[model samples]
Target: MGKIVVSENVSLDGVGQDPTGEEGLRFGGWFGQVGDSDREEWAKVGFAEALGAEALLLGRRSHEWFAARWPSRTGEWADRLNGMPKYVVSSTLADPGWNNSTVLRDDVVSEVRKLKRRVNGKIVVYASGRLVRTLLAHDLVDELRLMIYPFVLGAGDRLFDGIGDRKPLRLVGSRTVGDSLALLTYQPIRDAGA
Candidate 1:
């Protein structure tokens, strides 16, 4: 089965939104805020892993936000994400503006399960707090790759809000970048008979 991975750029204080108090609460490029050579390398590694993914799962809001920006980007990472098949969970979005994008109109868990069965590579999820909470609640996420920045935003969206259940995860990797960002990777431990 393909792994469902959540990769996000969050803050040290568990804040994932408006870290820089930028417009639209985007944090003014949170991922690239404190860029250095080491941080750049870390981003390259993360983006490369995302490029290897067979599919991308995004929330409706994220889909629309990215579709408007990434498709016009010229970098390799942007190209990869824009070109790969995307499964967007949405009720209002009947037609996504981006290419290689599909709407998930039914049950999120069931549809994601079906997609995993059919794919042969990684399924990457990025910046979808609601969707991330659903996957965590349902025990569907296989891995989490978090790039924790140094800044702390007092308010914004978070990935762990409203989670109902708890599942143990094992830390498989950890690295610190020059910009004080901790690159953490965790894998969910499977329970017996699960």
Candidate 2:
């Protein structure tokens, strides 16, 4: 069975929106707030994670976003991402333009469950906040990896904004990356009575 890992870059206040400032949201570009060394370390962490993932799962918007940027980039990370099997969950997307990309147009829950059974290794998800919430609500996510930046974006969309219940998680790993980033890994505690 595959492990559904939801990886995200978030602010100190848990805001995960507009990290690249492309959305034009207020406080959008928190991703570049740190120094060059810190950014380099963060990139290294992401590269390592990408190296370990067997496939990528994303929502439509995230798929479009990544497809637009990663296809033209040249590097080990970009190459890996561009070449990996990508599944995008969307009701409207007819064609996924990125390389090795597939559009999952069925019921999101059912499609993801099928995907989990089909994949043997890690299916990593990135920058798909809505899909992450759905996965969490349905108890589909196996691991949550968060790279927390130092800034506090007080007014942006947060990671856990619409989760219906208090899902408990057990901390599996944690480390400080670069000067100001906190790399935290968590596994969802599936038992209700724990």
- Model 2 residue runs over 4 Å out of place are none
Candidate 1 residue lDDT tens string, 80-173? 8888999999988989999999999899999989988988889999888889889988888989988888776656666676887677888999
lDDT of 1 at 59: 96
For every model shown, the clashing-pair count is: 0, 0
Model 2 Cα lDDT, one tens digit per residue, 76-187: 9999999999999999998899999999999999999999999999999999999999999999999999999998878999999999899999999999999889999999
List TM-scores for all candidates, in order.
0.88, 0.98
What shift in Å separates residue 179 of candidate 1 from its native position after superposition? 2.9
Q: Compared to the true structure, candidate 2 yields what TM-score? A: 0.98
Q: List the residue pairs that clash in candidate 2.
A: none
lDDT of 1 at 82: 80
